[model samples]
Target: MHVPDGFINAPVSIAAGAVAAGAIAVSLRGARRELAGGSPTAGFEDNRTAPLGGLVAAFIFAVQMLNFPVAAGTSGHLLGGALAAILVGPYTGVLCVSVVLLMQGVLFADGGLTALGVNITVMGVVTVAVAYGLFRGLLAVLPRSRRSVTVSAFLAALVSVPAAAAAFTLLYALGGTTDVPVGKVLTAMVGVHVLIGLGEAAITALTVGAVIAVRPDLVHGARGIITPLKLRVNGELVDAEAPAPDPVRSGSRRAVWATGLATTLVLAGVVSYYASANPDGLEKVAADQGIDAKADQYEHATADSPLADYGVKDVEDERLAGGLAGAIGVGATVAAGTGVLWVVRRRREDPAAPTHRSAGTAV
Candidate 1:
């Protein structure tokens, strides 16, 4: 959820800011390893990680715009932590959500600038941490199949949404600007978000399954865990082992990247127009519980931005304005996310280090 400016006090906001900063810093370092093809079967080099990470961020941004009705008078959008972590890596997933948050705050005026850190802490760090941890644990216990990966993605996303809600409740207890009872807030937040989590799980599992079907090697979580190819031997079926991963099979991720970007553009620019108009879970909870009493006192720092509120500032056509804003958001998120991931990749990819040949091709 996008916390507003006055929802939290100054001291706790600052502390949350520090926590966000620290998480980003650590993620940046960890991302270097992830982007460098560090996994046993991940043959990816800098190219795959950077472009895929950008696309993943933009996809998350696009999908987040499509808020589906979750309950009576309430809607929910994809939090995207499980999707990103499964597609890329956990560290890069955190950066993906962080990039989306930064874009929404500065350009879209969606999340309050003052609450940027809080949003990142709860949405980025908390969701990714919980989702990735649970996903890996489930994968360890479940059969190593594509279906298992999809199931893990679903379960991880299902848990992450409520976990994030709980984190927000705890933060509110420590630094809420209003006097709402913490127990009520927690119960309501958790209850509503549980329904929202079902939506999140469906989206996460479908997306992960689609990607795995097309390009399993590109999925960070699916790496080294795919069921081996089976061959019919003279008398029985047996595993067919590849002597070595074909470099060409690593192929160019350009096709997949381009396809993903196209899908992102369509979702943001066209599909977002039909998203549920009802207030999202957090907004509904805040309004019903009086938690946003002081939020009206403070204006968003980027309230005057051209793309504020996911609409063009001066565009008369509501559809045209929203469409344009969504397109712009996707482009900006892709650029910013790509830049950040490229930097992470560059820092760890030494000129002297041998190049890695990642497996799988989108075509």
Candidate 2:
């Protein structure tokens, strides 16, 4: 959930900000290894990984805008932690969700500026960390198959939402702006979020299964799980020689990117129009538990921007204005996310970097 301003006191918010910043810093470093394909000269594959990562972020942003009805009065959406981690990697997944939160906060005014850290901590760092950990653990125990990977993704995502909700409950216990029973709030938050988790699980499973079907190599979590075909020799199974890395097909890459971008645009600009209007898990919980009684108004410079509240300011047609806003959001998120990830990938490839220098000096 996008935490608005004044939900958390200044002290806890500042602490969460520091935590979020630290997590991002660490993720940036980890993302380097992931984007580089686990080697220094991995820049050759950057063309494939970098753009795919950006597309994942954009897709997550668009899908998140489409909130599906959960219970009678509540709705839920994809948090994207497990989906991104399965498609990309854990570190990159955190970056992807952070990028979405930043874009939503600054550009769309969907999340509050002051609460950026809270949103990042709860929705980005916590979700990614928990989901990816569970995913890896399950992958270790499960059979080495695409189905297993999808199953892990589903379970990981299902648990991550409530984990994040629990984190938020702990944070609110420390810095909530209003006086409310922490126990009841915790119970309600976790309860409602569990329902939301079902939706998250389904979306994650479907998406991961689809990617694994098409390009299992592209899925970070599925790596090494899809083994080479074995041969029976003398009634004994032998590992087959691994295939060579396929040449980069620029046309295929372009096609996939174009198709993904088009799908994101369609979802945000058209499908989102029919999304459930009910309040999400967090909002419903807050209202029911009286945690939002002292909620402060969202006061940001861009609060009055044309695209604020996911609608154009002067556009009279609600549908058209919302569609334009969604389209713009998709474009902006892709551009911003792609640029950030490109820079990170390039930094990893920097030959003059300190790590390279030290290694050279040692040699």
Candidate 3:
């Protein structure tokens, strides 16, 4: 949920900001290991996951443009924190969601600027925390199969939304700006989001399952769960996921990149136009809770941008303007995301070289 302005009180907002800052700090270190190099994630070091994380962020952005209605009027988009965390590692996932949030807040103005910290804390940190926690817990109890991983993805995503609502409630309780009863806000946010969570679970599971099915090697979270590489022993085929080769040669990576880029464009340019025209989870919560009483319209507000408000700035034809806006948005997000990801991947690759040192990393 993109928390708008004026919902949480100053103290609570500041507190949430501090919490988000700390989480981001922790995630930066985690991202370096996940991307750059080190133990616990040697296979998933910085270079590999960084560019991948940026792509995930951009994908989340494009997917969010295509909101689907859940309840009668309320709707939701991919929250992405859970999905990203499960697909990537949690530390990198946090960075992924943060990137998406930052883009939305600054460029798209989808989320409030003042409430930036809250949005990241609730949507990014909380969802990742909850989803990853649930996924790990389930993994421990369930079989260590690809199927189990998919199942975990489904359940983790389903639960993350409501858990996020609970976190929002606690934050509001700490720093609510209005007179609305905490119970009402909690009930409404959770109730509407439950339906949204179902959509999230489906999307998350399907995406994770598909990636695991194809390039399971690309999925940071599924590193150990790969089926042993099939091999010949006598006359029978040994069942095992293939071991990662020392120097990974490009295998269908071009195809994967092309597919991702194509998918992002289609979603942003075409499918987004048909997405449900309804207020999403946070918007609804704010209206219902009187938390949006002071949501000042965004500055740098795309009011003049040709694609301002997802419509061409001056194009007279609604269809044409919207189409162009969508196209532009797709291009921008893809380029931005690809650039960020490329940097991360390059950094990850450097650490693998014998002459590299992991010093001088700025948090």
Tell me each candidate's TM-score: 0.92, 0.94, 0.85
Task: Kindly report which residue stretches of model 2 are placed more than 4 angstroms away from their true locations once superposed.
Answer: 41-43, 233-236, 350-363
Task: Evaluate residue 315 in candidate 1 and report its C-alpha lDDT on the 0 to 100 scale.
Answer: 98
Q: Per-residue lDDT for 205-253 in model 3, tens only?
A: 9989888887886776676775566878898998866466655435465
Compared with the true structure, all predictions reach lDDT values of 0.92, 0.88, 0.77
Please give, for residues 212-325, the per-residue lDDT of candidate 1 as tens digits.
Answer: 998898999999898788999998999997778556654546778888899999999999999999999999999999999999999988898999899998899999999999
Give the per-residue Cα lDDT of candidate 3 at 268: 78
Model 2, residue 218: displacement in angstroms?
0.7
For 1-363, candidate 2 gives per-residue lDDT tens digits of: 888887898999999999999999999999888888766565555577788888999999999999999999999988898888888898998899999999998888887777889999999999999999999999899888888999999999999999999999999999999999899989999998999999999999998898777777788998889877999999999998877765665676677789889999999999999999999998998888878877755476578777898898899998999899999999999998888889988786566755535545655
The best candidate in terms of TM-score = 2
Going through the candidates in the order shown, the clash numbers are: 1, 0, 18
Top-down lDDT ranking? 1, 2, 3
TM-score of 1: 0.92
